[model samples]
Target: MDLDAYVAAHLAEWRRLDELSRRRRLSGPESDELVERYQQVATHLSVVRTSAPDATLVAYLSTLLARARNRATGARTGTWRGVQRFFVDRFPGALYRLRWWWVGTLAANVVVTGVMIAWLLGHPAVEQSLLSPAEVDQLVSHDFEDYYSEYAASHFAAQVWVNNAWVAALCIALGVLGLPVIWLLFQNVANLAIIGSIMIRHDHGAHFFGLILPHGLLELTAVFVAGGTGLKLFWSWVEPGELTRTQSLAREGRTAGTIALGLIAVLLVSGIIEAFVTPSPLPTWARVSIGLIAEAVFFAYVFVLGRSAFGRGQTGDLDAALLEDRVATQA
Candidate 1:
């Protein structure tokens, strides 16, 4: 192929694309022309790469196409509207669509925790084996309660937020494996069961509920959401249905990202409650009520905002334009 001759033939179209991309405003016809030129230049770049393999020409066309893409898509990165749309539409839409996964997770964990608590209460020997009498006394009397107030409130909230975020991230990050997510969730509830059992066995059941319920309600829910979303991702590849395995996994993985990002704020709220409200001087009823309200508000957000977004055909995935350029598939 004559590289110079090919460049000569398409140089005007490439230059036109550059000019359109640089313009602040484009007319109706100009916008259509810009898209047309972008596609042509993209094809030209593909040809140059495949046939001629001209490094300099490929670099220029690549940059030109990138600029044209940004201009054509309006490049919404880091914008307030983009953030708003994420929370209002994408995040909740994902939550609503995948509600059963997380909801089932939440229920199963609750049942397992409850059974473990019961078993521990009935089998006192197990508790004794895990913790000596003195250790159990300390946990029930001081350690459990002081854990909340041991750190300064603001510092504790930030610390808890980061830790919880890491855990949730792991759930999504390791979701593809299928077993790591369950292990994480199991370890989480097992710890809860052990503590609750010891506290209740020692006649401090009221104290246990008072401290934990204040934040545990929403905190555990966030964990469950993460666990469920991870499991869903695993299932995407396992049972991809009509879509190809790659497409199903990609769709679920992207939605998992949305849930992971959204869970940061959710976990932060729980952290704040855990740090401040759990150790506050307020009555147990009031603290528990605050936690209940937070939990309620989260559900309403999922059911209302998420439902609406899903009804509008939002799938929490990137827009079609952002996902891929409209390139012609050449044989």
Candidate 2:
């Protein structure tokens, strides 16, 4: 093909694309026309690359393609499809990748809590020092158990959801500092340990477990995930591997943010269970079993569904091409 003739033939279309790209405001017809012209120029650019490979033409088309791409992307509106992808792929994928971090945190926290409970149970004097005799008596006799039934279920569920979500958010937001994540988790574990010790010493260990297990299992798991994700974000820069520290932190931060949103739902479920199931008239076994079942479902979701998504290279982040510095990451 004669290069001159080819250029001349499509010169009008190229000019049209340039004009449309430069326009400040577009009518409906002009917007449609711009898209059409953009597609045509892309095809023209492809043909020039293969058939002619002229440097000048190639450069011009490349610039035009980029402009068109930005315009097209900018014009597109957000959709529910994006939200669906977030939950179906991004959220689960992030959860799976960070499972080890959160799981480890969870294990350590549980051990710490159990140790504290045991120590307090065995040493009445130690427990007495932590709270006054009258305070301990009040908690053991009423405050602990009545915590579940003090408010209406719906109100309690909303309250619990917001409070737990806030804690999870704090773990993620303050995760960059490293020590704060640990401190926040320590606060949580301390509460559970104190409550458990008091209840068990009063011969109400069964009641404590009964009230907690229904919501605590899943609820606590969500908290663990948040702490784990936060700590991982902190480490991303500390041990950035092949990536630059900036790149590593950016990637992990995006994933951690996604985990935060996902945990909102998990916490909400636990809140519902705490409000409805924990305080229900159901037998202790039945209540605890419900909690176990809910926890099992979450595990299956992460290990099975989440693992699959992660294996497929889903990182629970926006595409790298969307970010300026992510075009060619090292690791």
Candidate 3:
């Protein structure tokens, strides 16, 4: 078909495509297809328009080509804006609504800790069964008191902080795989259970509390935050709310990522305390006081500070609309 004639005929469809592209609600494959189609049509039109013998005809074709290009550009820009809005504005709002999940996760942590304490009171042999020979040897020979004293003396707090922060980040990041987060939570809980059991078995459970509680509060809370991050992603896969499973997962994934990053910072501070301050042979009262303070700080951050720090506020049903738009656009 002649270039000018084809452009005239397909102008309406091209305009529609341009509008859709600008909206950027389309999937990657759909957007790519639309861009390809636009490029192909433009190329063909360009050839026909340039070959026109009449100057007026050539000028008219050029104008049409410019319009098509402008529309395509506008569509691309709109799509980017939509995506930014989804990430920066929409996702955090959705996370804020999921406050119940965070509370449940914290409750779960307390339950797990209580279970460990109960198991320690009930079973003594289970501790030995759970630990490998090497771990037992390390526990016995390490003189944790002296080791922690030396750690407090050394300026290695920053290094400990970085290492733990990385672990928390990894736990959250890998949680995106769904099952990995479950595995992480199980491993962490099991380790704590065994450690608590072993300490009590040795008649040092009270002593262990004195030694570990100072920092354990922060460290364990950070773990819970990491678990919460993983849980959010896993829930997205399991229950996508108003969105299809895939769409929900994608939307939740972005919010989960931000939560994971914040968890990392919490873990880092916890690690510094655990490494340098917790294991020392501090008096029971001192340890208890520190642990209580740490717990208070953690609660404050999770409940009061997090909302502002994360920029959470009422999104007024925007998330639902976004999901609907995504589904409709995909269809």
Best by TM-score: 1
Candidate 3, position 89, lDDT: 50
Ranking by lDDT: 1, 2, 3
Whichever of 2 and 3 has more TM-score, that candidate is: 2
- Give the lDDT of residue 64 in candidate 3: 46
Q: List the lowest-lDDT window of 10 residues for candidate 2.
A: 322-331
Per-model TM-score versus the true fold: 0.88, 0.79, 0.60
lDDT per residue as tens, model 3, 242-261: 87898777766766665655
Per-residue accuracy of model 1 over 146-217 as CA lDDT, tens digit each: 999999999999999999999999999999999999999999999999999999988999999999998999
- Pick out the ten consecutive residues of candidate 3 with the lowest summed lDDT: 322-331
Which candidate leads in lDDT? 1
Winner on lDDT between 1 and 2 is 1
1-331: candidate 2 lDDT, tens digit per residue? 6889999999999998888888778888988988788767777777777778899988888787677657655544266776777777888899888889999999999999999899888888878778898998899888888899899999999999999999999999999989999999999999899889988998888888888899999999999999999999999989999988997998899899889989999999999999999999999999999999999999998889899899988877765434422331111
List the candidate 3 regions with Cα displacement exceeding 4 Å: 1-97, 128-142, 150-155, 279-282, 307-331
- Flag the better candidate by TM-score, 1 or 2: 1
Global lDDT scores for all candidate models? 0.91, 0.87, 0.61
How many clashes in each structure? 0, 0, 1
Candidate 1: C-alpha RMSD to true structure equals: 3.0
Ranking by TM-score: 1, 2, 3
- In model 2, residue pairs whose N, Cα or C atoms come closer than 3 Å (at least 3 residues apart or on different chains), thus clashing, are none
Off by over 4 Å in 1: 1-11, 23-63, 326-331
